[model samples]
Target: MFMNSPVPSSIGGIKSLARQIKHATGASHAAALDSAAQTARFQNYAHAQRMLAVHVAATPLADARSDLYPLFLTFYWKDKESGERGRETLTIQLSAAWTSLITAQQLAHNRSLYDLQPMASDHLEGKHYCSGQMEAREHACAAARVFQFMDATRLRPSASYSRVYPSGNSRNCIPHSDHPSVWFDPATRRYLFVDEPYKRAIGEREEQERERWAISHLQVIAKATWRGMYNPLQQSGSQIYFISHAFSGVPVKPLVAAVDGIPLCTADHWAGESATATPRFNSPLAGQPIPKAKPVPRARMQHDDPARPPLTFHREAGLLLNKLISLCRRRAGIKTHLESVRDVLREFLMRTSAEEDVSDAEVLAIYEISNTSVKPILRPDWPQRSALEEDMRKLRGLLLQEFAFKAYGGALARHLGAAERSLGVWH
Candidate 1:
């Protein structure tokens, strides 16, 4: 069925594929329909139908460039103090989201080293104790969700966008654009956070002092028709690459195996067969109770509570104000009118903090300013004709939407409604 693996572009072709699947597997028609849907990466027949109807044949249905694969990362470590050597592996399905395999491998390696360096301090410090394999792996995974991994956390939220994954904790979260050190090329849209291990350092000064892992072996256990790989034994699938890298800067035996899929044992490495031997030191946090994650406080109310306006309201209002200022700064419009709108937006921003709820009084004050300071500027008959009339009109529409919130109910909302009507803005 995967031969050439071309997805059906038409409903007729889909039905025909469904028939083929039904005959080959002796499955029910409905089961065949679902199996056929999987070929397009949709959840079911109905979902495929809904997406196909709106998007048509031009939509991306199983494009290799858009697909994400599973990634498997394995790390090897040795503690010199007790002569303990160990190896551990972690799988990050999210890592496959990086479409470029080369970039994905480098990111996985850099992020893993950055995360594990602290946990394996003994290796760097020449101390007598080794680290717990499980604890280090756990920490690396947690840190990966915030930085190296891409999803809702790394993406900038759009006004109407919804995400499948829950937003990461904002306190620890730093959006990609806001990251301090990571390099991003706006032209190519490439992130150059990790140095490419495959390439050699050009000069002595360019050589990093830190210890890191280099991809020594990589293979795809099961090559899918799509661009990525999968490991059936682990019940894992993705643009997954099973990777093993030996630790450099410190002498450590690279865990060797006869083939990609075969399990590494004591006999595999040329070193002594002591893979089962116990390490001298235990994990510092091994016996301690795992700390529970603190519940994040609600920044804004879900309902339009008068006392607590939705956070989106403040954000949108501020954005609208900023837009007004930018448009006015063009200076092509009437000087007085442009300055008046800019002053009103600046005042409103100053009075209200982005972090706080915009109260009814503040809302009323800004609306009144819009009527007094801004309305005259937007007048079509105003002397010397404001070139920004169209821009101001659009801004006024957004401003009205912001002020028309139900949170400022009762007399305030009523008065605002009257003010909007006078400005020729309907509810």
Candidate 2:
């Protein structure tokens, strides 16, 4: 990922050349003044400096400190809204790749709260925010990746060097040092950016903030990728469930009594009565009293009483019979046949009431015999009574399936066993 760049040919004599420029230009006075101004600025923003410095100082160095070497050089621009212009500052740092430099520039541009680059001295009303010292450090750290990449090249510098103030602005001019662009510390083995001011301003712990920022950026990227993948299915009513058993534990059924108005009963009322019952015992009377107990009359139980039609049967049959009687009264085309049909229905019910088990086949045989009796009064196209008998059979099957009676019977047996165990009862 490192961008290739031609190495400077002569780096050894750069120190002598820098000294010559320093002596000829006589710019030490100006440099001293700028340094004093920077110190004053740091003092004025003590809180910010402290925050950034502590962060930078806590960062772990990558390797043992060694000779410093140049990594990257970048420029920034600053403009004032009040028509007052600002001087641009070139940020120099030791990194392994140019990626860091690009990241730093992007970050600076994103932080709209500050007018970065020119190092504004005067605070503009409503326009000036916090100083860009933090932004500068951010840029320098990002650019460190370039230096790291460059160090891997292992090219040594030669002494032949030249000095030139590429710009005519006196305020923007900076001096070069004979020190290697970056050096590795023996104890920490980290390449240090020799700009003492910038390093101190950034401090060590700043990497944590950078890491947090990177994680957030990654989250955004992941979300965007997921959204893109699901875009085609957005309109369909489908949903994706991302379940994590580690965090949520196992799934379980809720204890509610019903789903959409259907009731679910537990073992407490399995058969609409308590499972246990008290036993009743009758003792034989003494010899003197036993003789008088023989004549006691037996009371008839409800099951042995005279058969009365079920309420539902009475209601529905009466309604159907009444409709047939109305047709007879109207003297409709099939009046006699309707009357015969009504009589047959009444006879069939009477016979069914006497039977212990009215199976479908038996019911169909009854319907056939009854239809014969009424056949002479009806048209040939009239439906046979056996059709109605078959309909009843189908209805019975549907009701049984809908209620799931057989399945529930098994469930009830299991629940009863569980309850028995809970009650410490065997059998």
Candidate 3:
């Protein structure tokens, strides 16, 4: 059945009606558009319907197919709008079937923004029906929900529109793989590029914290590196991460190239050591267990000055020993409560290998000192030579035990004992 023409060839009237229909993009405009179709103003009605469908395509849909296109088509031009009734052989039932054909085209038009193109020749599984064919339509059903997370993250305003990629421009309709380092979720109506940005933000925050720790702890080594770099994003292996000093497989370091023995950036540096990417870095194989610091031998006194007391360079004990030895040689003495203990330490080290550098730990098993005043107390002046010697002997035993000098004996231990016995006899 054809729609009853209300006006007799009213061209001006049709133009006026189309103007009114153009104003509405929602289903509320359907009644007015259908009424115009009955008045032989099908051009205006078709124009209005397509315009509304385009807007609908851009907006999120609760259900794409459940819209006003078909309802209005039949309301205006009943059964004739569908072209023909029974078709044993396929043939065009009518020449004027724009109302029926274009009404269904809303499904295609409603999806105008999304253009699906072959990303990679991956094994695609799809289904077919009698009406037509489909390519990646299956993705629409089982798509990943991304907007909820985006909303929660507040990275972008959830209520606002987001820029989708393949970009309707990138030449490829679908994302051609992804943003290299950024993860892309296929199911979200729009691709979610939030993961990489979040990871990058967090990575940078942690990197800064690691840098501060390294700069503070590594001290001079860090300063030397800064001086060598001359300031160009001076982040180092020791700065960005502590890097287990072993390959653990998450892409912390990138592979590098070198020119004339000078190193270049790694695969990670060029490609970007972004959160999603793995980079190879250059480092020495977890270097030989930091060679047990070869016990630095002391320098012998040039002339024995009785007043000054012929002294030898001392290597302090425990962790601070290395730092103190490195410093005391260049700078003047610093007075702490451990001053006397340090002096005693110097005397012990002077006579340590005075005979033969014995490597036997069990040779000198120490019994604990009965003198409990072992605290490193400050003394203004030396006591009588004999008293100091007696105290020194006890202190030496404590030091030997504390430093695990289990085998500290033989001719050297004999010499250390002898040297402390003679002094300026102060008492």
Query: Over 4 Å off in model 3, which ranges?
Result: 1-262, 266-312, 315-340, 352-427
TM-score of each: 0.25, 0.17, 0.14
- Give lDDT tens digits, candidate 1, residues 121-230: 11111112236444333433333332222221132111111111112222321111111122232222322221122112222332221211111010001112221111
Task: Name the candidate that leads on lDDT.
Answer: 1
Sort by lDDT, best first: what order? 1, 2, 3
Report the lDDT of model 3 for residue 378: 33
CA lDDT of every candidate: 0.33, 0.25, 0.25
Worst 10 residues of 1 by lDDT: 247-256
Compare candidates 1 and 3 on TM-score and give the better one: 1
Per-residue CA lDDT of model 2 for 25-96, tens digit only, reads 665643433232222221112212332333344453222111121222222213334432222122222222
Which 10-residue window of candidate 2 scores lowest in summed lDDT? 219-228
Cα lDDT of candidate 2 equals: 0.25
What is the Cα-based TM-score of model 1? Answer: 0.25
Worst 10 residues of 3 by lDDT: 69-78
Compose the digit string of candidate 3's lDDT tens values, residues 1-427: 2234234123344445544655643334555555454344222344334323433575543332222221110000112444322111000111111122222212222121122211111101112111211111212211101111111111111111123222223342121121111212122222222111122333556546544432222111011111111111334322111111011111111111101111121212221111111222111222223222122222221111212111222221322332222222222232222243444444554455454453233112111122333343233245433444444444344343232212222232333333343222222
Ordered list by TM-score, greatest first: 1, 2, 3
